[model samples]
Target: MRKAWALLALLGWLCGLAPAIAQVSLPADLTQRELVIGTRVAPPFSMKNAEGAWEGISIDLWRHLAERLGVRYRFEERDTVQALLDAVTTGQVDAAAAALTVTAARRQVMDFTQPFFATGLGVAVGRGGATAWLPVLRTFLSFGFLQGVLTLLGIALLVGTLIWLFERKHHEAYGGPPLRGFIAGAWWSAVAMTQAGAAQDGPRTLPGRILAVIWMVASVVTIAVFIAGITSALTTQRLQGVVRNVGDLRSIRVGAVSGSSTVDFLNAQTVGFESYGLPAQGLRALKAGRIDAFVYDRPLLAWTIQQDFPELEVLPITLDSQNYAIALPQDHPMRVALDVTLLDTLRSEWWTRTRLRYLGNDAAN
Candidate 1:
């Protein structure tokens, strides 16, 4: 009886071991399972082509990941990045891929795979309205320029008065009545200062001629200084309108992609901006003068501007540098798998080739 009891106990132990071994050896069937992927129109990352077919760097990466995992996926277009995040959080989609920047706030709600790309925010402005003359005109109206002009006028009046005093007694040009002589001296001084010849004979006395010579030299120097000031003012004015850094964005009409981190940054800085569903839309608004500047991902915006909006320019300044990653639901079962694949892909030559293909040769590092 003891032997039979031992045999039954051993069988039960083996039975328990069998299921555990099976669980360890046979993985879940991820193959052929339909995975819904959420995405939005973010160029060089994810976008719909001319034929309404999904194609981009992120789309291709997702396809490659699915192929490697022996899974099938269908992309579902979302209007905004926030919508995509919501879809993943609500289990509406298995994953989302775009030029999605990974942030601490986003990490709290959704899991992001290892970073595949790195970029920053860039500013874009239209080329048509950025004329050099506009800045020059603006400079002429500035307080500094006005002050310089006023000071120059005061010096000119002083020289005119002195010339009237010196030439009034001797030279015919200033021999008339006091008021008339002074008026003629003022006219002659104005003409001499402009490098234009005087309409009448200059002062005749030694003191008067010496004064005239000094005034002529002073006028030459003053004119040169004034020209230099105008040039400097023009340059300053041109740069003033340019959105070089985030702080400069406040006074301009800025546009950002709706539900994007760029919009969050702009809002945090209290900069007034218009939001668009896509980068292309924001570019359109910039070109149409609806917005003075457009802010978005550096690489994606650079690529789009280079390809479609040749008239626009990306600013040299980059803001809020961040890493781009594929977003998954929090504590997702596939998180580890996707992360492994992403890390491998980013380290491989495939990443460089893919990036160059989509972003072109001038892609931001």
Candidate 2:
């Protein structure tokens, strides 16, 4: 009985020890393992400095995590966010550290570490330019303006034909050849309606003169309506500004960074947008008036506007709020370890300090 009890106790002890041994052995080779980290230039998150060295919040975060894990890493630059995600998904790189947003679609292909940042879509637009007369003039000649003018002309022609019928028998001004008589009466009607009194004699018939007086009165109201419409159109074109929401995106030329969540959002909304490889490219396009607005991550656009493009403005609206996380291949060995470290780091003072250092006063909560 004593031997059997001792054997049972030993078995339990070995069972517990086996897990410890396995846990301890797992990271033993981590010190010798070199991880390939993929990244892109996404300012305030990850970027390559003028010295050709990586720097930013994401870079520092990865460096600290690697040091804590006793693992070595080398960063490979991907041209765009899509490229970075693809590298990790395909196992071409062990991990990706950038402003990669965590979404259900992406979660299916790869695993993400605990979220380190939260942000949403933003719209950036060029600063208001000098209010010029040329724009107003252009508005006046717009298609809508021409359509209104055509409608007014048609009304004037119909009224003129009525006046010609009433005055043609007795008034010399309407007694010429058929077409010429009609043209003369039309000119007289136009002059009277515009309050630009005609030099020709008055119609002999009372009905003709009565019709002229009525047309002159109606002209005042019609002219006022036309003027109001033109003014309203001009004001609308000048002050329309950037898109405040997805619905407003339809009428404007929009730009998005290639492979970003912005593109996905725009596509899902069926809002056509032009894609650029970098935010800088999109900003340049906006400045050059090639694109009316740029849509991207709100925090990134805010950081960029605060840092490099003060002339531009970010709309106060936000869309498709998302959390950004470090991406790793599905079921990667380091995924859980990284997530543990990342969660702890996010709750630490270091994360706050790092965010403040790069994001300035605009750090997201």
Candidate 3:
């Protein structure tokens, strides 16, 4: 068996971060010739469970790659997404795992192994849209967000005029009682956009006390509308889902299980990205400032954050519906090895064992 030198960190750098690696051939030091690859926990592909074990399609694939190449590999259980990516950049490890997909952006930075599996984009909504407000409620009753926007403009004018005449004429949006001003503006915006005929109240010489009273009432209604809008999106969609595009995710930092189809899709689309060799890495990246959005299969990530990472919420849209595939770095030596290995593995009894290990564990749900 040929020895594949798994290099870790460049020889020298002051930052103390990992270093980039340069491959070398082995000279009979099997134990010393071991490769340390950076990786994170990406479910149904690659992940280290609470039980302290490595299991998944990607893991098995690596194991086979190591054996056929006759090299020893020690899978490092990485903690953060950035560290995993950094490891690759700095040569802290031979290569990363966790369903990493190959992409042009990443290609510019790091090399990839051949693909191992395929997965695609998924969508999620907040706990469920609120079901009480008219604006929100109206969504279920054939509502449009455009109307709410119009109402807000009209209300702003009416209030702006009254302020110009009576109150803080020179004040900006949040210039007054910070709380009062925001609540006033926000509530007005919410109301104006959701309702019709809000133009009738064009600032007819109102007192502060009277305006305050109206603002309070408007705030309450706005809350109701917000709740209703959320509820409509959730339940209605569950029964008959709404359709949205990935374009909405332009500004978001989407996370994928490294080489999964979702990562591939987002990469192909040229949306902003933060790749994770593991779901845990991506989630950690989402927290540690690597990226803002983490895109995954809706079913896989639906309750994943709520359950495993409760701080995150499902955005309003799902980008696309596509298949899942395992991707390695393009032209990786492992590509031919893994591709042929995959065909054979699919027929072997070991395949189901591999599949059951991480098949249904979608972090989203």
Candidate 4:
């Protein structure tokens, strides 16, 4: 009975450790080398702040994973999106943690963890301007212009018919009863198309009414086509009036870090963008009133607002959000090790406190 009890206790302890032991992971290639991490500084996520140098949501998560696996980590800070990608691709770093979108193109180069966040593109318009332009665009593209064109066409047809019919009647029999004050269809069409005030000699008979009907039908179809064309043009230009999305960024001069993610994003979107090499330089230009707006990731933008420029307001919406993932080259043996630890950190309590500390109220609840 004493041996049986001892054996049961040993089995229980082993069962509990099975998962914890299983949870520990080591880099396949690095062996004794510390894990190399590539991170971009963005605020409200990853950055150096009042308390201490910290990382973004994903970075913090990666830290947690390393601690859990009993592996030491050395962070390689990068300033641009391209630099970060180069680190991961060249095996300079075991992984990169940034708010990178899991795009199909990116997948061809690196392996991505399961998407942690789902986000889409958004536009930050000059608050008041977007509202003001909406109505103007609706009017400009609506079917209101069709009536005049149709009226003109209807009248022409009516007049031709009347002229032909009258001649036939005249030749057939009686001295035509002074082609009784009949309205001409062509007259109504001319008036409608030109918005001309009716003259005293205007069409005044039944024939004119028939012309009006024909013009109305033609006008309706014409206007419909015109409106559709206008809408298509607006869609292509994305400019009902002013710039709205990155797609419309061409309409305005956009500011960005010369060699940063913002630049890559614009190039990807095909936005007309100008690069200002340093972040402070771009903000300085904004303060000096040189540029309209700066384009970058939301967390970094928020960090900039808090650490550098406080007066400027960042509208709540992120221009175009993407999921933050730890990336590695396709054949990287550390891929599974990185993602597993990454998942563990995402659920850690320190993760929560770190966010609340930097983001305070701005952090997503």
Give per-residue lDDT, candidate 1, residue 58: 90
Task: Give the true-structure RMSD of model 4.
Answer: 8.1
Cα lDDT of all candidates, in order?
Answer: 0.81, 0.82, 0.55, 0.60
List the candidate numbers ranked by lDDT, top first: 2, 1, 4, 3
Q: Rank candidates, TM-score, best first.
A: 1, 2, 4, 3
**lDDT tens digits, residues 113-142, model 4?**
756544443222232333335535644554
- What's the CA RMSD for each of the models? 10.1, 9.5, 18.1, 8.1
Model 3, range 1-365, lDDT digits (tens) per residue?
12322233232342343321222233455435777766676555565668978866667767765665567778886665556666776767766766454556666776654344544456432333331122234355544555664565566556544443444444354346645655554554344434544632223335743774675477567657766776666566454322246654564445566555576677678876766665556766665545655777654564366657765556556565543334333344444444555565556666566665554453221
* Candidate 2 per-residue lDDT over residues 1-365, each given as its tens digit: 99999999999999999756433222555567788999988888898889989999889999998876678889999997888888988999988998899988899999998888888898888877532233466676678888989888887887788888888888888887889778977787777767776526557788888877788889889999898888787776655444546887876789998888888889999999999988989998888888888999988898888788877888777878889889989987787678767777788889899988987787756
- The candidate that wins on TM-score is 1
* Residues 127-208, model 1: lDDT tens digits: 7475324445656776888999999888888888888898888887787788888888888888889987644678788987
Off by over 4 Å in 2: 1-26, 130-241
| Cα TM-score per model | 0.72, 0.64, 0.46, 0.57
Candidate 3 segments exceeding 4 Å error: 1-32, 129-243, 247-294, 297-343, 346-349, 360-365
Q: What is the lDDT of candidate 2?
A: 0.82
TM-score: model 1 vs. ground truth: 0.72
